[model samples]
Target: MFDVPLMKKNGSLFAGIALLLGAFAGNARAEEMSLQQAVEIALQNNAELQAFRDEKGLREAGRIRAGLLPNPSLEVSLESGALTGNSGENAFSVGVSQEFLLAGKREKRVALAQKELEVYRWQLTDRERLLRLDAKSRFYQVLLAVRKLKLTEGAIELNRHLYQVAKERLAAGDIPELELNLVQVELARSEGARSAALEGLLASRAELSLLLGGKEVEPALPTGSLEAGGAVKQAQAELLRLAQERRPDLMALRAEAEKGSAELSLAKAEGIPNLTAGLGLKRDTTAVEVAGLEGKDTSYTVGLTLSMPIPLFDKNQPGLRESSARRDSAGNRLAAAASRVEREVAAAYASLSNAEQVLSLYFRNIMPQMEENLKLTREAYQLGEVPVLTVFEEQKKYLEVNQGYLDALYQRQLALFKLEAAAAVELTGGVQ
Candidate 1:
């Protein structure tokens, strides 16, 4: 006859071994990556950075075109009296004219183009700064997701163990059926939370892969703990100063305002009139009554012509007005950018301070106490001094405490990132 209980135990052992082996295989397949390595990959492969670089190249081409002089024009004319039997009275003329810009117009145009190119370079710098910030944010988000998933798994496993204990106690008539049913319900809830956490982890990884530019990336695990990051080291006043000096967006706007000033100067210079000079050659085959010359004789003449516009009615007044208005607009925008940077630096600094305080509270008091309480509750249940429900409650509390600590850690890191981005400088050494 079959030993039914022994067979069931052996089946459970085999199932546990299978799950362990699967976990080991999965771990073996994952690659380990640090946050710095992730940012480096994003910098190399990000599509938006490539687009910005291409735009800079386009601006360079435009700058070169702006430096070139205008093209010279050619003119030609022919006249004949063949129908009136005066074929000898034929004349042909050809001329070449070149318009020369006055009032240093060419130099002004080239200078404006140079300023525009500088603006583009500054724009590229700002784009890189923003993209780097986004990449770092995504990297930390993945780390948080991984931590949450692990926490959920731990909670689920603990619940499963407690549920098994409850079943054993009920079978031995040490606990009521209601107690076992409650543990069963808690186990189901833990399992559902784990499922939701897994979905979240998957979504976070997908977003990270997109930021990395393509689908060819390897599956990698974040190597560090959430507790590794530190708070910002600089004061808000110092950070605001750094923002004014180093922030790429602010610099780009400054360049824009300078370019606008250059444009206004160029517009004013356009009011000056240009000089047009022409050289001409004429040939006529004719006989004059005062000259005893044959009709076959050829007469040649050369001419020089100089022309200038009166500039009496319109002298680029509209262009000057438009450029002046744009220059004013640019100045206003730059002032606004400076104000916004100040506000952001102050806000980020405050958030970092609060996060540091919360994290300190968790590390010093809450987490340790929850862990100790869980251990004591488990011991009391074993000694028959406490019910299974007490152990379950303590374990749930411990999980929540750990979750809160992770949240605080993430918040601190996020605030640090925002502060660094706003200040346009590095304030700490590691993890950031």
Candidate 2:
């Protein structure tokens, strides 16, 4: 005889253990983070961004070096006439000299360095702007993957329920064994799809984690919808104007042009040779023989000297030409960057407009019809009013349509990211 109470007790104990394990697993899962938080983390900890930021320190050091004055030179000398048999005839001298910069060379150097630093700052800002776009793009990719996984899971559940119903109909002699086999095959397909979707989700999460500077083992769950938040209301003209005014890369190019001009001026100033001024004190001693005694006479003297190069051969001709060419190049580059920005903004704007239209169509027309058809087909299959193949076709169609909508949503988000990057302005207010 079986011990009924003992078996019931054992079953309850096993269920309690399973529930506890589930709770522990849920607790161990990483917390969900918002898009803004994700962006902030990336900005703070991303390795590439941090390395770019380190370059600012180098520019700052250059500025420091440019403002500093040259050190003064010191000269000391001793002259002894002992070798020439004049032991008391000796001279000692000390002098200090400074090279004074002419044509405002030091000031011009400082100006050029300051302008270069400004260019670097603008370049760093441009890098940060691109990083924000990248983070947002990756965040949306993870969101799309999550939705795909969920869709696959739902498909698996639906197929499993249909398979169970088909088995019952086969036993009741209302459906053939072939129908049950078909449902079984569809369920297996759904399972395979779910496995692929899970793999995709994991890959997307890993990519997101790397972007956010998080360890690969600690990927945070993204908490947001894939729905298009709002339509881009800005006109192309307005976006172009914004890009011209606010784009950091354009600003950097303009700064570079100014820096080149400063450099040319510095080179011109450098062609003027600096004047070196020296001040010195000297002492001289002499031996005098009078009667039978030797006496020493000493004299002290002060002198000043000034010297400068004639600049006959090297007048920094090469430097001047190089700076001039660089200035012209910078100007041309700025113009080209502006043109590229215009094209990018136009292209992104058109893409976003098209994506919005497609997403709207799916939302208003296609998806509702797809859901209704899937529901009706499922009901008809359960009632034996439709063949198994009809239900399978409808389910597959529903899954395909939903996946297409998800893709549309993902594409629209990508278009928004590109537009924001091109225009160098925030269209949607989030972590920007």
Candidate 3:
């Protein structure tokens, strides 16, 4: 005869072993990382961000080049009359000349380069801002997956415990085979759900690893929650003001507009032709015949010369026109960017407001009531005052309600992230 109590104990032991094995297999090499740590890692290691940082060197080089003086040119010439049988009659000259930039062209070029560097700096900051937002979003997704996996594990345990109860009752002839069969079915379903949840967790972890620039042999486990932070009491007007002052992309555009102005000044300066000044030493040797006497005469002279372009037809008209057009275009772009910032701030604020209300409703009403109902239903089931189907239905309801609550939490957190990114300001504390 099969001993029901011994068989039940063995089944419980086997289930425990299987769960432990599954856990070990899933997280064999997992390393726990916090949300802040993940964001830091991404900022430090992201290939694209590093590439943007390298561009600062090029901008700095341009600034250096703008401040440099042109190299002086050296000229040497010799003239001989050897073909005319007068080798002694020769002339040689050596000269050096430097073309000096006029009308503050060099200063304006340096200013333009500096403005360009400022623009690049702001652009790099904007990239970092966006990268932080992406990392936070991906981290929250991993956290949500972790929560689901735990929820499924809890459900499995609950169903397994009830399965044992049903089995004991069946052995004592206190319940029908149909009731035991129903508990068995619920247990199996919970186990299957756990498998799916685990897969979801793995997928989320893989995505996070890629973002963090990690070639992880096993995915890093995220350590964070989707709990709501303090409420954002600031109005949309305040947020928009903050965005105008803090948004890096907006600042980048402003810098670019300033750069265009500097370029226009440079183009106007360039219309003034540079002056090239030269100093030279000349030596002349001539054979003279006076009163039938042959003699040599040598003379040396030093001369200074200045030269410049006529600027008759090309007074940099094309350059000036291009610079003026660019300046106007930059101004228009800045205005358009400001309008877009207003729109983004308004949209993010609306989403955050809606998410906060939904999350509050779940916390203040649905979650507590669902927990209480589930507790009562389980008690009634154990006391034989309710059918297994009633317990099963209540358990399913608890899972569904909790899942909905988790979704609410995730949405609320995501909305908060988007709001912060749009505003380019931290409204509340970091992720909870």
Q: Whose lDDT is higher: candidate 1's or candidate 2's?
A: 2
Candidate 2, lDDT over the whole model: 0.83
- Name the runs in model 3 displaced over 4 angstroms: 1-31, 172-182, 215-220, 290-294, 376-394, 429-432
Q: Estimate each model's TM-score.
A: 0.88, 0.90, 0.86
Model 1: per-residue lDDT, tens digit, 206-317?
6877887766554554445566665456778988988899888888899999999999999988998899999999998874554665546678999999999999998999
Candidate numbers sorted by lDDT from highest down: 2, 3, 1
Q: Which scores better on TM-score, 1 or 3?
A: 1
Model 2 residue 41 CA deviation (Å) reads: 1.2
Off by over 4 Å in 1: 1-28, 83-85, 287-294, 384-390, 429-432
lDDT by residue (1-432, candidate 3, tens digit) is 111111223334323433543476574344567777898899998888998898889999999999999999999999998999998799999999999999998999999999999999999989988998899998888778766766787788889889988888789888999999989988999999989987787677777778888674234566655773778988999989989988999999999999999999999999999999999999999999899988989999999999999999999999999999999999999999999999999999999899888877877887777778888887787778899899988888888887887788888888888888888977764321
| Error at 403, model 1, angstroms | 1.7
Against the hidden true structure, what lDDT does model 3 obtain? 0.82
